[model samples]
Structure formats: structure tokens, C-alpha cells
Target: MKEFLSFIKKEFRHIFRDRRTILIVLVMPIVQIILFGFAVSTEVHDARVDVVGDLADPSVRQTVARIDQNPYLHVTAVLGSVAEVAERFRAGKSDVAVCFERNFDERLRHYDKAFIRILGDGSDPNTAQMIVNYVNGVLSTVQSELSASEGTQTASFPHVQYMYNPAVRSSYNFVPGVMGLILMLVCSMMTAISIVREKESGTLELLLVSPIRPVGVIVSKAIPYLALSLINLVTILLLARFVLGVPLRGSLFLLAVMSVLFILASLGIGLLISVVSATQKTALLISGMGLTMPTMIFSGIIFPCESMPVILQYVSDIIPAKWYIIMVKKIMIEGVGFSYIYPEFIILLVMTLFLLVVSVRLFKRRL
Candidate 1:
């Protein structure tokens, strides 16, 4: 009994002595719980809604007011014409557009029915549906209030329309997210592990003493992974388009260019991970825990960042996958051109440059 107790005490001491392992075991659960509890939600909030109709009409104005007042929706613009709805959506300014038909009040009084069209950006089908549901709920409440005052039923409802993805297919939403995930997994994890393996095998030291520059070595190692990532990108695109029935609505050339930029950004992240990691196992662990988890959770891939807490939303801003996913959706589903997605492009460009410079500097110091 004494010997067994001593062995148990030694095991506890060993565990407590390793701070990294202790930190992982203790901190990981707390962080994940906080993130999942506070940062992930299915509910929509502050979704940009565009209202197009005669604000002068009492009924139309009332309904718009109700929608604006709803906690989940925000009336970002009140447009003069229905035609502007499409223009706003194309410009990525609106998530949901509420267009009241002409003579909305008269139709409600005479025919007991008035039509309002609700247009949603269906690139993210789940969010689009939620926005429409919230709008409908507000309209329903307003209808009830107006009907009660008039002592009759007011048959006024929105005719919902979804652009880009008319059917609101889940596949449309998942493909881009999956693309981002696969790229990060392949580019970051593989590159980091590969570099670490070379170091473990002592080949890195041999290469360092040779004539090749450190930057060149890193680039050469990254090029193969970059090429593989491109191939994987093509495969995912083909699968999304042909196998999954997700349409490629925009310029394929533009999609390719943006995808290439994203690939470079991912490779840069991998290089940075490689520079920091001392062993293959360490590289794999960091790439998995640091890169994969954040990419999957906080990048607006599975959850809408708008619904997240303010702090998590801000943290998501630094995630490269977030920008890549946005770019993909805007280009492939929204059919927008470079002008609309330039901000995402600029962010990715800056991240790639920053990671590359840091990795190169670190690698040189190590050599």
C-alpha cells in the first residue's frame, strides 16, 4: 500500500510539473466552452434589411417600422424603388429586402390582401431563411395589430424570394466552408509537419549549410504544398458544382484568382507554424488545435459571426478563413466582381505578406 501510494504521488507530481500539458488540459475546455456558449448561436441579429416602398403609406411605414424595431433585423436603407433591392444585394449592402407593392394600403382595404416581397441573399441559406422568418414574424404581429383595430382580418403577408440559391440548398453553404477547412488542414498541417520532419531528420541542418537561401528553401518546400492545395481546390470546386449541384454563378476566372490568393495565405500560415514548431508532433498539435479549431468555429463557416458576442466577432476578424469564406460566397453565389470583394482580398493579401515576412525572419534566425 505504501509503494502504490508513492507511485501515485510521483505520477501527480509529473503531471503538475509539465505546465504546457497542464495548461492544455485545463484551459482548452474552458476556452471551448466559452466559445461554444457565447460565440456560437443559430439566432440572427442585426441582419441588414433594405426596405423599398412608399414610406408615405401608413400600413407600409408601420410594417417597416415593426421590422426595424425587431431585435433581429436592422433597416439599413429605405429605398425609393423595388429595383434598388437587387442593386443593393449585388453590392453586398443588404441581407434581406422588404419591398411593399404599390398601393399597399388600398389593396389591403379593398381585397383584404396586400403583397410585400421579401428578397433574401441566399448564399448563406440558413441565415437567409432566418432573416425571412424574422421579417415574417414582424409582419405577422403588425398584421394582427392592424386587423384588431379595423375589426377584420388583414390578409397581408410577404412573398419571400431567395436570390443566388433559390432552393436554399444546404450544400451551397457547406461547400465554401468545407473548402476553407480542407485548405487549412492540408496546407497548414502538412507544411508544418513536413518542415518539422526535415528538422527532426537533421536534413534541415545540411540544407542550411548549403548555398540555398533560407527563403528559397521555405518557398521550395511550400511550392509543392501550394500546388497540391490548388489541385484540392479544383477538386472541391468540381465536386461542388457537378456532384453537389451548387452553381458557379460568377466569373470562374475571378474565383480562381481569389482562391489562389487564399491558398497563398494558407501556405504562409503553414510556414509560420513550421518556423515556430520544434518537433513534428508539436507542429501537428499546434496546427490542429490553433489553426483547425479556430478556422472551423470562429470563421463564420458553421455559425454566423453577426450572432456571436461582440468580443468573439472581433476575434473572428483576424481569422483568414473568415475572409476566404466571405470571398468565396460573394464571388460564387452572389456573383459579385472584384470591386465588391476587394476588401476581403486586401485583408488576405496583408495576412499572407505578414506571415511570410515573419516566417522568413524566424527561419533565418534559426539558421
Candidate 2:
């Protein structure tokens, strides 16, 4: 009993001595709870609504006003043509577009039947469905109000159209998320472990000082992982396309290029982790436990960022996976071109450069 108590006391001291272990044990759970609690909501909050129709129509303006008044929806744009809906979507201007045909009020009055087209991006089918439901509820309220005011029993019919994912397949949303997670696992976690193993064996410094060039050493370590990650990417694409039946709508070349950029960014993260970590176990904890949750929650992978709180949405911005996943969804699901995705592409590129440069500088400074 005395020996057992002595060992327990020593174990407790050991655990409390490492600040990182304490942080992983204590702080990580708190952070996870807060993030998951606030960020995992499925209900669409303040969904961007663009009204595209004849602005002169009183009924059109009234409907817009009502949509704006809704607590969950905001009318962001009043466009003159339906052709602008896709442009707004590409520009990230709207979550849902409310389109009224020409002479909406006239048709509603005479024919007692007018159609309000509801357009939503379907890459994330769950959010798309939620947005449609919210918009439909608002439109139904407007339709009832208009009918009562005009002494007519007929209401404007809402026709919902989902872009990119007309079939509303959950796989459309799942594949990109899994892709981001897999690349992070391969490029970030594996690379971190590989470099930390060398550090643990005390061989990393010998190699660094052996005139191989530290940058070259880092690159050499990363190259094998990069090739393996690309192979994984190919496997994922094949599985997604043939086995799961997810469409590869955009340029396959473009997808590959974007994926390479993302992989490089992930490798940089791993390099940074290895630079800080003193042991292989530390590297695994930081690279594996540290990154996986944020990637899932903040990357818009399992949850839509738009539905999250403002601060949480901002948090998602710094995560590389978020941009990569967005670009992937746009390319794969929407079949959008380079012009539509240049912003995300540029963000990922800057992140890759920044991470690599910072990691290299830090590695040199530390070791």
C-alpha cells in the first residue's frame, strides 16, 4: 500500500509538471464544449437573402421587407434580374435568392397565381434544406398577408431550386470534409511524427548541421508524405466518383492543383508542430488531438459556418481546411471555374507560403 501510494503521488506530479499535458487534459475539453455548443447548430441564423425581381412592384418590395423582418433571414441585395442569382451565389453574397418574375403583383391580382423562385446552394444539403424551409415559411407568411389584404384566397407559390446538388445527396457534403481531414492526417500528423521521431532519436540536429541544408532536410521529410497524400487523394476521388457516385463537376486538373496547395499548407502545419515538439508523443498529441476537432468543427465540414456565431465564424477563417473545403465544394459540386474560386485559391496559397516560411524560420531559430 505504501509503494502504491508513492507511485500514485509521483504520477500525479509528473502529469501536473508538463503544462501541455495539463492543457490537453483540462483546457481542451472546455474549448471543445464551448465550440461544439455554440458552433454545431443546424438552424440557419441570419441567412443572406437576395431579392431578384422588378423592384417597382409593391408586392415584391413588401415581400422583401417581410423577409428582412424575419429574425433568421436578412435581405442583402435587390437585383433586377434572375440571371444575377448565380453571380450572387458565386460572390458569396446570398445564402438564398428570392426571385419574383416580371409583373409579380399583376399576375397575382389577375391570375391569382404567381411563382416566387427560391434558389439555394446545395453543396451543403442540410443547410440548403434548412434555408429553404425558413424561406418557405417566410414566403408563406407573405403569401397569406397578401391574400388577406387583396381579399383573394390565392397565394404566391414558392418554387425551390437547389443548385449544384439537385438530388440533395449527403455525400456531396461528406466527401470534401473527409478529403480535408484525410489530407490533414497524412500531411500534418504523419509529417510531424516523422520529424519528431528524428528529433527524439537526436539525429535531426546531426542531419541539420551536416550541410544538407535545414530547409532541404525538412522538404526531404515532407516529400514522401506529399506523394503518399496525393495517392490518397486519387483514391478518394475514385471512391467518391465511382463508388459513392459523387460527381466531379469541375476541371480534374484544377482540383488536383488546389489539393496540392492544401497538402503543402498541411505539411507546413506539421513542420511548425515538429519545430515546437520535443518528443514524438508531444508531436502526436499536438498534431493529432490538437488539429482534428478544429478541422471538423470550424472547417465547415460537419457544420455550416454561417449557422455559427460571429466570433466562431471568424475563428473558422484562420483554419486552412475551411478554405480548402470551400474551394473543393465549389469545384466539385458546383462545377465552378477558376474565376469563381480565385479568392479561396489565393487564401490557401497565402496560408501555405506563410506557414512554410514561418515554420522554416522557427525551425532554424529553435534548433
Stretches of candidate 1 above 4 Å error? Answer: 1-153, 365-367
State, as a TM-score between 0 and 1, how close model 1 is to the true structure. 0.61
Scored by lDDT, the top model is 2
The lDDT values for all models are 0.78, 0.81
RMSD of each: 15.2, 14.3
* Local accuracy of candidate 2 as per-residue lDDT tens digits, 218-301: 777677667667777887787678866789999999999999999999999999998889898898888767898899899987
- The alpha-carbon deviation from the true structure for residue 91 of candidate 2, after best TM-score superposition, in angstroms, is 46
Find the 10 residues in a row with the least total lDDT in model 1.
Answer: 29-38
Error of 2 at 154 (Å): 2.8
Residue 221, model 2, lDDT: 69
Model 2 is weakest, by summed lDDT over 10 consecutive residues, at 29-38
The residue-level lDDT of candidate 2 at 251 comes to 95
Error of 2 at 264 (Å): 0.6
